[model samples]
Target: MKIGVMGAGAVGSFYGALLARAGHEVVLIGREAHVAAIRQQGLQLSSQGETHTIPLHADTSPAALVDATLVLCCVKSPDTLQTAREMGPHLAPEARILSLQNGIDNLAALRSLLPHTVSAAVVYAAVGLAGPGQLEHRGGGELVMAGDALDAAGFRAFDDAGIAVRISPAIEEELWSKLVLNCAWNALSAITQIPYRALHAATGIVETMRAVMNECLAVAAAEGVQLDAALWSRIEGIAERMPQQTSSTAQDLARHRRTEIDFINGAILRRADAHGIPVPANRMLHALVKLLEDRPGLPG
Candidate 1:
């Protein structure tokens, strides 16, 4: 299989290298420093104290996708439309496009810009970009894909490449579940400059998470989406199991990178307004993250 990965960030490079290891021809479209590193020496996968090089092609341009049979849209939520435009003109007719992004609207955004068959993928992983051409895995790595349009061949191809994928009929629910989680922890932790562990250690922390999640649930209900029973207990499990981690949003702010508060909390606010639902909690969270995204770091 020929695969093209957009962004070549932590998530993109991690999956791209895994597929390459499984014998697929993978091409990563990333920044010049990382692209140069991958081209000079294969992509390096560092996880659980293991590191090795996986041979693959890398380029800084979307043109690298010309021969791909599948396109993995891995850019951050804000860049979805722009990245889709850049990769739009080069997509193959038969290539299957999968959105491995954080937000729910990313698939719809990409579909509007490109003619490719797009699927929403539910990502369950904790990985980061350690440096140029390098991926560091911190947690789980499994995927649940949207719809039946993707088949066993596709799953096998990716699984053979070490990236596991499953077909899901209720992908919207999955997205909302993750969205609520993101809302609960991402921006708050980021704003406070605290990791998940420290963020949860304070008083009213779990209560705070529930307050945000209840707002999300109300919004989801008004929008007529059903959440799985797994939400509450699953999120409850997070604090005890992995409380030390900060959100991707928090990490973005820490590095001075643009955060995706708009798509996450901002999305909720939009939907709440659309449905006449009250989302003061979400609105306030959105405002704080916006303030942080606009300003520099938390004060010294």
Candidate 2:
């Protein structure tokens, strides 16, 4: 299987390393520095208390995707359409694309731009780019994917690479559930610059998270997505599951790079406005993150 990972940052690099380690042909399309490092040495993957240097192809061009049978679209939310446009002309005729990103709209956005089978996977990994050509996996690497994009061969390839995947009938609800979890933690973690366990232990943190979760739930309900009633428990338990893991938003802020707040909490704000529902928690978080993005030097 020839697999290409677009926007191969932390998540993309982690999975690409695994698939390559499993003896599949994998190419990572990413930034120049990361790609250069991979081309020079190899992809350094640190996971489960062990580090391995996995040799794979890396390129800074979408043309790297030309021969790929499967492409994992892992770009940020804001870059979805533009990345799709760049990669579209380079993809194989029957290539399947999977969106392993945050937010609910990426799948539709990809389907809109590319003439290919595009599906989404609800990613449950706490991984990050430790440095150029380096990926660190804190914990959690399960994926819940849906749609007709992945055939049996594709699933088998992912399974052989040690990626935990399951098909779900209600992918939208899964996306929303992940969104709600992001809304609850991502911004707060970014602002505080702390991991989940420490953030959850802070004074008044539970109440704050509950308030944000309520607004998200209200927005989801208004949008007609019936999320799991026990989703909140799962959200709360993220701290216990990945205690040291910081949100990707936190990682972005720490790197002084752009974030997907616009798609996470900001997504809720957009829908709430459309439904005439107030989401003060989401609103405040979105604004604060935007403010930080604009003024990176500001103290939190």
Candidate 3:
């Protein structure tokens, strides 16, 4: 089976390498540097203190996706529309596109832009770019796919690649739950440029997170998704479990790239506005992240 990974950044590269190692034909569509490096030397995958080089196809062009049987749409939320528009014409007619992105709206955003039936996956993974053509996997590599349009062959293929796959009846709830967590920490980590532990250690930070989370919960409720009662606890526990971890937003800022603040926290604010609920904390965080994105050189 031919698998194409669009936006072959950290998450896309990790899965593409693993699938390639499992003997599937994999092609990664990404930047020129990563594609060049992969063309010269196979993708470098590092996990659990070991590194492995896996041979695969790489290209900077969306045209390379024409032959893909399955396409993993892994671009950040901000790039969803453009990616869908660019890749839609190139995707094979029967090809399946699964959104492996953050934020709750990417699935709809892709479906609206593409002609094919797009699926959503609740991705549970921690991957980061080690360098060009390099992916470092930290932990948690499981996937929960939603909807009935899933291809049985695709499920088997992902399973064979050592990726856990399951069908969830309440995928929206799961997504909203994750959104709550992202709202709670991503902006805080990005603004302070600190890891979860340090962010949690700061005075009044946890309470501020609670304030943000309560608004998210209210918005989720208005949106007809009842989040888990343990959501707040899980949000708080993330810091303890991943003490040294920085939010993706923080990483984006550190790299001087665009952050998904608009998609994550900004989504919450939009929903709150529609429902006429107040989300001052979320609003402030979202605005502050945008400010930082616009002028990243701003000092404390």
As a TM-score, model 2 comes out at: 0.97
Instruction: Give the per-residue lDDT of model 2 (tens digit) for 1-300.
Output: 999999999999988998999999999999999999999999999989899999999999999888899999999999999999999999998999999999989988999989898989989998988889988999989999884659887998898999998789898899999999999999999999999999999999999999999999988899898889898899999999999999999998888888999999999999999999988988999999898898846333
Cα lDDT, model 1, residue 241: 58
Rank all candidate structures by their lDDT, best first, as comma-separated numbers: 2, 3, 1
Every model's Cα RMSD, please? 2.5, 1.9, 2.3
Where does model 1 exceed 4 Å of error?
Answer: 147-149, 240-244, 296-300
Residue range 195-271, candidate 3, lDDT tens digits: 88889999999999999999999999898889899988888887777777788899888888888998999999888
TM-score against native, each model = 0.93, 0.97, 0.94
> In model 1, how large is the Cα lDDT of residue 4?
90
The window of 10 residues in a row where model 1 has the poorest summed lDDT is 291-300
lDDT of 2 at 87: 95
Where does candidate 2 clash, by residue pair?
A: none
Clashing pairs in 1: 196-243, 196-245, 197-243, 197-244
Model 3: how far residue 279 lies from native, Å: 0.4
lDDT accuracy of residue 252 in candidate 1: 80
